[model samples]
Target: MSIYLCISGIVFSVYLIANLWAMSSNRLNQPGYVLTDLDGLVGVRHNSLSRLFSGFTTLVAKQHIRRIQVSSECLTLFTDADDCVNIWLSDRYLPINANYAKVLFPQAEFVDSPFLP
Candidate 1:
């Protein structure tokens, strides 16, 4: 009985250690999206796992972009097809500015509108 208890304790310790390491390394595979600058196009990337498991379903082309609107909460991208993509700004994503817009979408007009969209 003592031997079984010792073995079970060891196994539990190993499991706890593994979980701690995974949490510290952020390998738990959280659901989130990242925007990648693809020169002329903006790629919307989903999933933080291996690229083979991830998907880029939405791609915003530079030439097709009608205008770029920035608000206090988020940045909106208007396309020629009347579709708007909102990229919410946070402290992690950095503050919005004209230089940042130019670097991200150089061809599109950056509109600093008061409207919150």
Candidate 2:
């Protein structure tokens, strides 16, 4: 039982370390959409695990965005079809200027969304 607990602790620690490293790296800004053009229907590409895991299924097949919506806690991008990408403001992948998202997406409806703890 002690050995099992030790192994579990090690695994958990590794997971936390990896997540922190990824977050501190700022990998999301590598390549993809710009905040200014997002409202104009420009597509943003992000491959970060933090942002990707937020709503991966909706965005996996979407390459182009037709609409952008910003709430207090999340940013949702819609494809031309029915797909969408959702990014939580609390995620490290999110740009520091995330507050500007609301200004860029003025028509976006405000809603309650999930955030990282």
Strongest candidate by lDDT? 1
Across 1-117, the per-residue lDDT of candidate 2 in tens digits comes to 999999999999987876566445554432233232433343333333544353432223223444555555456766557576665443443444354444444554434334434
Cα error, residue 109 of model 2, in Å, equals: 12
Error of 1 at 66 (Å): 1.7
Q: Write the per-residue lDDT of candidate 1 for residues 78-103, one digit (tens) a residue.
A: 88888987654432342433345556
Quick one: RMSD of model 1?
9.5
Report residue 29 deviation for candidate 2 (angstroms): 3.8
lDDT of each: 0.56, 0.48
Model 2 CA deviation exceeding 4 Å by range: 33-64, 71-74, 88-117
